[model samples]
Target chain A: MTYFAGIDVGSLSTEAVIIDEDATMLGYSIQETGADPVRAATEALREALSLVGVSREQLHHVVATGYGRINIPFADRKITEISCHAMGAHHLFPDTGTVIDIGGQDSKVIRINAEGRVLDFTMNDKCAAGTGRFLEVMAGTFGVPVQELGELSLKAQKEIPISSVCTVFAESEVISLIAQNRPREQIIRGLHRAVVSRVWGMAQSVGIEGAVTMSGGVAKNRGIVALFEENLGHSIHIHSEPQIIGALGAALLARGEIHQK
Target chain B: MHITRKEYLLEQKEKGRRLMGVFPALYPREILWALDIVPAEIWDPPLEIRQAGAHLQPYICSVVRLGLELILQGKCDFLDGFLFPHTCDSIQNLASVIYDFIGARKPCYFFYHPKIPHGHTARDYYLKNLKALAAELKRQFGPLKMDSLREKVDMGRRISELLGELYDLRAARRLDASNEAFYRTIRKGEYLFPDDYIAELEGFLTQTRSEESRNGATIILSGILPNPPQILTLLDDLDVQVGHDDLLNGSRRLLISNEKPGDPFEYMAECYFHMPPCPTRGSSISDRMRHLLSLINATGAKGVIFNVVKFCEPEWFDVPNLQEELKKRGVPSLVLDTELNQGLSGQMKTRLEAFIEIVRVHRESITTKH
Candidate 1:
């Protein structure tokens, strides 16, 4: 079976996925971006290839996506993260009309047409306060592992309000709340609420359509996903491994490239 | 002393020097100088009250519209080339339209500077831009002499030093000239020869120290690039002296010191980095706002006028935040949208007059109680 390879070298992580001619996922891998993106991407690709038992010669085409996509010299074609996210979200759930992606450093809300084409999108790259980095910092302050934040926050008795949207100021506010003996769960919930509020602001800018699909690493945070659902006043459909959506989209695009050739 | 720009153009034509007009601060001045072209800034569009509306949309920023109006009127006939930088999206699209439609005769060159700030990658990108610009200049204007480029750089450095001193004097309120006169002097210096303009500024500075003002409200004007003269003229007409301004044309371009100048390209990148950044330059709106506020307090200004260009996203995002911050400090601010018309001067004057009157009444009440 001929296989297509897709690599997504994101700011915080690297993901690779392999798919067959019929768009069946053969194998996929995700790893943290340690120091060098080139090394991380290579490692992720190797891991994915080992899982599928496929050699490099079996690959029909290679596609890359995300901020570090340009650095991947081996990729045959590079696509924008916005386009990839929209395609991936549409592929997972055909009814998804909007995609809200909150990554490590950037947040984007894309409006997709019925044909899964990105009609328009808006990105907030200038701030890290509403992204995954924001949640990571808040989790660190509360002495909670970042992975456990979402589950613990769901147990909060009351929703506490976080007034500061800035990451640095919010960290100080979290410390002050701790000194005041505020419950860690409530504060974490409030942190999620704040992040959702900021993302909602961006979503409103692009006129967010319903049937929104949440993608990127932040989608794994159940606290943030719940907050986003509440703030947006609609249910959000998330992928099993949301971070791999970009790679999946890239692989699908590579499949299309082979057909065109 | 009172030569019209038309007359100056005629003289340049006689001397066979190609006059190329550029706008605002970040244009590649060194390249133009090396090409032996006279770099003139369209600080104010020479509008005749009739043709402003047909050429520019009222919703657009006046400075940009005025620039368009100037090109439409054929006032730029003497120019051989125009260099537009990717400052804002509005100006970028404007440059595109002018290059395709309006700027028919003059060859227009545009540069896309990366929007990222304070990152090593961005700095390296800026250095790459310098080399690219140098190569473009060589292709367009033949090979340039290193000695001549160094000479021009030194000339620009000296002029910047003089401009910085002028800003210092204005900040201290030691210069006795009206805000309009001071702004015009600087505007003229930007238009004329650097060394000659410095000599003229030195003469004016020496003469102005002894004079005194009877009544004027010290105010700070904050904006992206206040190159047009109408805003300053309106402030002057309303008896409001601009104690400090944070626009690119005013203080942002003047803050670069020439102390460490070795490689010209490196110097250009360093200057771009160290120059007082505009709100549009990065994500640090709070830092820029704080810097402007500190300058305002240092100058003892009573109010601020945020002259924002309409439809300019960066400035639009910044103004509301700055206004809220300034209000927390009990400082009142007025945002005026720039339109490319001579009539805007009157409207601006009325706004300034009202703002200054409020400041006066506020001050009087405190003085009476004291």
Candidate 2:
């Protein structure tokens, strides 16, 4: 059976996904992209291949994505995370007409068609206000793990509003709220709401169509997803592992290219 | 090609030619050429804003900010005079600041072009303004000789014809030029004397003409000006060609008239009236849409890219409507908010690349159906 590999090296984390000829997912791995993206990509690919019990030579093709995609020398092709996220979301949920990918540094709202081709899209400018980085920095300010902020936010009785659209200014706002002895969970919920509002503005610009799909690390946060669903006025599709969708899309594209050849 | 703008201007000054520092969009270049003056257009000079901030507000566009900064830096000290066209509110305000506040020693000339949807009165107003500018220049320089003005107007018309031909060839994909090389050559006209600029364009046409169409996906660039020229390099690398432009610095300024020159001022006004629609000139949204559609049909462009400058009120006001109209017509477009001289960041690159991919998909779909 033929096999394919997809590696995605982002600003904060790296991911790798392996698939078979039938496009069935074999396994995947996620790692922190510490300092060296190339090393992070290599190790993540190795761990994924080992978990699938496949050798590097046995993989028919390797596609790399994300901002660090250009550093992966061994990959057959480098595609932008924008296209990859759209394809991945469409493959996972065929009804996906719009995709909101809130990644580490940037956020994108992509409008896709039935065949997973991008129709139109909008992204947050060179700012971290509407991205995963915003939440991570807020979590750092609260002296809590970034992964736990979402769970903490779900317990909030009242949601305070985050007025600042900048990450630095928002962090200051969070610290001021903390100084005033505000509830931590409420502040966290406000942060989530702020992110939702920022990304929702982009969604409106693209004019959301059909069903929406949430991808990227931010999609893993239940609080953010719930707020997005509330704003979208509809439920969105989310995979079990939201962070691997970009790599999954890349792997599927690699397999599709092989068949075309 | 070998001489820098400074070197050429210095040489012209030594040769007793007056140089006027002209500001952005829609002006009578033939009038300047007729008066034996070379207009050094001040659009996007690559200089940091050191002293300009003190004189202007933070919200003003960089085109104005940088133009003011160049003056503050004493870069225009050697120029004979300055001309400010009534292009937009920011420029009009800047003109007031320069003439009233900063008090530069040189004489400042103002040209007011009529907004669109005007009748015969507007044309009369434009002609009156043209004569006013000429009479104002005569006080500082010598008398405006009729024969000299007529000859310079003819030279300006030749320059326009050559530029139009080059644009036609590129739209037909029958030109062997990358986006960077093409813009670099065309932008030389901003400072070159009319005779010398005509020679450079004629040389370009003779050398770059191709019987076979070039290979690439064609697109139209609509913007104030193509600054941070790295976009052109990036497009060339991606095998995308800028087939035509609606930029204030490019085709928006071209005179597409083939009629015989009657009166120089009247001819210039006719050319101005016939040029492409622009926001600075108060063109209606429908008129702009019709003009863009005609360009798209003529060039077979798959997409349009509005490379807008950050904080540009005129461009920002029109972009949403233009984009919406294009969308309704089944044409895809991308809007990039950019600042002058700030090269493409990683985020901008990703966005540009993804948009190109979408355009490629659109092209393939059309090809399959045909």
Candidate 3:
């Protein structure tokens, strides 16, 4: 059985997905990127391969992606996360024509054609306000885990408005709101709204195409997804492990590379 | 074989050539050359913003800020005069600050080339401005002899002809030069004496033009200047060639096509009107879009990259509409907001790579269909 692997080394975390010739995903692993991308990518790929009881030598092809993709010495190919997300999202949800990926430090809205090829894409320009890092910093300011903020925001009776689009200024605003004894859930929901508001502008630039798919680590946040859905006036499709989508796409691309040869 | 701009200017000064520090966008260089003054364009000068910040607002672009800083730093002490073209509001305000507030010891000349309505009145106004500028330059430096002006105008035409050929070669994929090398050769015209610049361009054309076409993803660059040249170097690394450009400091200023060359002053005015549509020149959005599409069609470029300088109001205003137009036409475009002289960030690199990937995909789809 021929095996293929894709590793995505992102700013906050690294993920690896293993698949076979048939493009069926067999196993995956996600881990913090920390300071060493090479080590993270290696360990993630090893863990993913182990999950499927496969050896590194058995893999026919390997593709690397994300911010630290250039750091991977063993990658047969390095594709950008933009194209990977589009292909991965379309593969899972065949009807998907648009993809919204809010990663650690950047957020991008990609418009894909019927063949899962990227038609157009727009990303936040050197700003973290519309990205997952913004939510993580806000969660830290609230002294809550990043993962819990989403669920906590769902309980908000009324969301206080977050007017600052800058991450630094927004953090200070959250601090001031906490000082004013504002409801924590309300503030959390407001932060989510800020993120959605920022990304909505990008989505509008590319103009959402057909059914939208949400990928990247932030897509796992139920509150953010719910806010995006409300903003779009339609539900978005999200994979159970959304963070692995980039790697899955890379893996599929790797499999395609072999066929092309 | 190549010397720095400062070094070349110093050599020319030693050779007794008077240098006029020229500001951005449109200007009558033939007049300057005719008056025995070399125009050293002052766009994107490499300088830290210390004294300039105290004078100009933070909202001002780096092109103006760096120009101010270059002057405030006393780097233009060797310059004989300054010419401020009416390109944009910030540059206009910077000229006022230099002439009125800072009291530049050197003579300051302002040329308000007519924007929009490039009709009879605009031409008459441009011709009048050209004569006024020549008169002012004569009073400051020397006399504007007619024969000298005629010869310089011819030289200007020759330079433009050569530039057009060079651009045609690149668009046709016959130029075997990297993006960095091509821009480096073209930007020499900013400071070098026209004769010297023409020689350098000829040498580059002879050396780099190839019978065999080069292979790579071709794209057009639209911007004020390709500063932080690391972007070009990055494109070189990625095997992406800048097939053509509409940059203010580049084709917008250099690619002057003049059919009516009967008189020197009239030819200069005609050249100004014939420049590629630029927002700084008050070019209409539709005109700029048509020009961009024409370039893409001529070069067979799969994408357009708007490498805008940060805080540039003129470029900032036109980008959204231009990008929308390109999108509607099925050409992928990327907007990169960059500061002058700053290194390319990792995020910017990723964005550029991703855009190239999309362009490659577009190329493949077209190829498969054909």
Per-residue accuracy of model 1 over B1-370 as CA lDDT, tens digit each: 4776567656665776567667654765766676666677765565754554665565666656777778877777777777677777767767877877554577777766667758899989888887787777677776778777777777777777777777777777777887767776777655665555667777777866644533556788877655345777656766677888877667776638555778776776777777776755664777777787888877878778887655557778788788778767867676766543434542244344445644554455557799
Candidate 3 chain B least-lDDT 10 residues: B253-262
Best by lDDT: 2
Candidate 1: where are CA atoms >4 Å away?
A1-261, B48-58, B101-103, B210-216, B224-234, B237-239, B344-350, B362-370
Clash pairs, candidate 1, are B62-B338, B62-B339
**Candidate with more favorable, higher TM-score: 1 or 3:** 3
In what order do the candidates fall by DockQ, top score first? Answer: 2, 3, 1
List the candidate numbers ranked by lDDT, top first. Answer: 2, 3, 1
Instruction: Point out the higher-scoring one by lDDT: 2 or 3.
Output: 2
Strongest candidate by DockQ: 2
What class would a CAPRI assessor give candidate 3's docking?
Answer: medium
**What range of 10 consecutive residues in model 1 chain B has the weakest lDDT sum?**
B339-348
Query: How do all the candidates rank in terms of TM-score, highest first?
Result: 2, 3, 1
For model 1, what is the C-alpha lDDT against the true structure?
A: 0.75
DockQ score of candidate 2? Answer: 0.79
Q: Relative to the unseen true structure, what is the C-alpha lDDT of residue B10 in candidate 1, on a scale of 0 to 100?
A: 61
